[model samples]
Structures are given as structure tokens and as C-alpha cells.
Target: MDLLTPDLGLFIWNLLAFLILFFILKKTAWKPILKSLNEREKGISDSLATAEKVKAEMAQLKSENEALLAKAREERAALLKEARDTKDKIINEAKDQAKLEAGKIITDARAAIEQQKMAAITEVKNQVGNLVIEVSEKILRRELSNKSEQEKYIKDLANEVKLN
Candidate 1:
């Protein structure tokens, strides 16, 4: 029973001591504690704001990177297409040049063949002319050896000419 109920004077003294301690703490430490807490809250809010700004900038940079990548891809495709077109044009030109060269070669070969044929014909004509002269000399020498044979040959040649 005694432990449960305190003396009135002791209770009053304890109350007075608690009030004095509270006022002393309030006067000496309360303002600085509150100021420190406010400063910590402001620092946390500033850090959060800075983080949000960085995140936004990162998102913007990511979008810009994607745009640059797309542009690079387009440029690469264009370069490849141009290269393919240039390659095709070069191949076509080479084929055309080859065809022209072949045509020229064929023309040259035909000209050479024609020149050879003409030379062969002229040589054959010259050989025939020489053989005819030789044959005529032999025939005239044999026929003209006798006056009677020569007269007969001349009369025969005149008759052949009149028939023709």
C-alpha cells in the first residue's frame, strides 16, 4: 500500500523538478534541435530533387541516343545502297566494254580473213596465168617446128574463135 501511494509533498516536489528541467531544456536545446531537424529535412528534399532532375536528364539523353542510332542506321543503309548501285554500274560498264572489245576483235578477225582470202585468190590467178603462159609456149614451140603443123594450128584457132 505504501509503494502504490506517494507522499503529497514528494509528488509536489517531483512535479516542480520536472517542470524546471523541461523549461531549462526548452530554453537551452529546443531551438537548435528543431533547426537541425529542419536543415536535415531540407537537405533530404534537395537530394531527392537533384536525383529526379538527373533521372529526367538521363531519359532525355537516352532518347537522343536512340535518335542518333536511328540516323546512323539510315546513313549506313544509304551508304550500302549507294555502294551496291555503284557496283552494279561498274559491272555493267565493264560488260559493255568487254562487248565492245569482243566486237572489235571479231571485226579485226573478219578483216584479216578477208585480206587473206583476197591474197589467196590473187596468188591463184597469178599461178594460173603463169601456167597458161608455159602451156602456150610449149604448144607453140611444138606446133611451129613444122610449117604444115603451124598452118593447121592457126586454122584450128581461127575456127574455134569463130564458133565462140
Candidate 2:
């Protein structure tokens, strides 16, 4: 019973000390603690907003990269097509040039062959004329060995010419 019951003067003094301590803490520490908590909240919100902005920029950059890649692919295809066309054109031109060159060579060869044939014919005719002259000279020398034989051969040639 004595422990449970407090003296009035002690109770009044304890209450006064607690009230003074509470007021002192409120006046000295409350405003700074509240200001620190508000600053921390604002920093967190700013960080989150910055992160969202960065994420949006990354998405836009990814789309731009994809567009650039598509354009590069199209350019590559066009360049390859142009290269193939150029190659075909060059090959066709070379083939046409080869055909013309071959035709010119054939024409030149034919002309050369025809010229050689005419030359051979002329040579054969000249050789035949020379052989005929040599044979007639020998025959006349043998037949005209005596004057009487020469006269008889001349009379025979005249008679043959008259019959023809």
C-alpha cells in the first residue's frame, strides 16, 4: 500500500520536470527533424523522375537504331544490285567485242586465202607456157637436122593447115 501511494509534493515535482523536458525538446529539435524528413522525400522523388526520363530516352534511341539498321540494309541491297547490273553489262560488251573481232579475223583470213589461190594459178600458167616453148624448140631442132627433112616437114605442116 505504501509503494503504490505517492506523496503529493513528489508527484507535483515529477510532473513539472517532465513538462519542462518535453517543451525543451520540442523547441530545440522538432523543426530541424521535420525539415530533414521533407528534404529526404524530395530527393527520392527527384531520383525517380530522373530514372523515368532516362528510360524513355533509351527507348527512343533503340527505335532510332532500328531505323538506321533498316536503312543500311536497303542501301546494301541497292549497291549489290547495281554491282550485278554493271557486271552483266561489262560481260555483254566483252562478248560483243569478241564477236566483232572474230568476224574481222575471218574476213581477213578469207581474203588472204583468195589472194594466194590467184597467185598459184598465175604461176601454174607461166610454168605451162615455159614447158610448151621448151618442147617445141627441141622437136624443131630434131626434125630440121637435114635440109631435105626440114623442107618435107614444112610441106606437111602447110598441107595440115589447109585441111583444118
Weakest ten-residue segment in model 1 by summed lDDT: 155-164
- Give the CA lDDT, 0 to 100, for residue 142 in model 2: 70
Measured on C-alpha atoms, candidate 1 has an lDDT of 0.88
Reference-based lDDT, each prediction: 0.88, 0.85
Indicate the residue-level lDDT of 35 in model 1.
97
TM-score of every model? 0.77, 0.69
Please give the TM-score that candidate 2 achieves against the real structure.
Answer: 0.69
Worst 10 contiguous positions by lDDT, candidate 2: 155-164
On TM-score, the candidate that comes out on top is 1
Q: Which residues of candidate 2, in runs, are more than 4 Å off? A: 1-22, 144-164
lDDT of 2 by residue, 1-164 (tens): 97899999999999999999989979998888888999999999999999999999999999999999999999999999999999999999999999999999999999999999999888888776766565556557675678888777766654544211
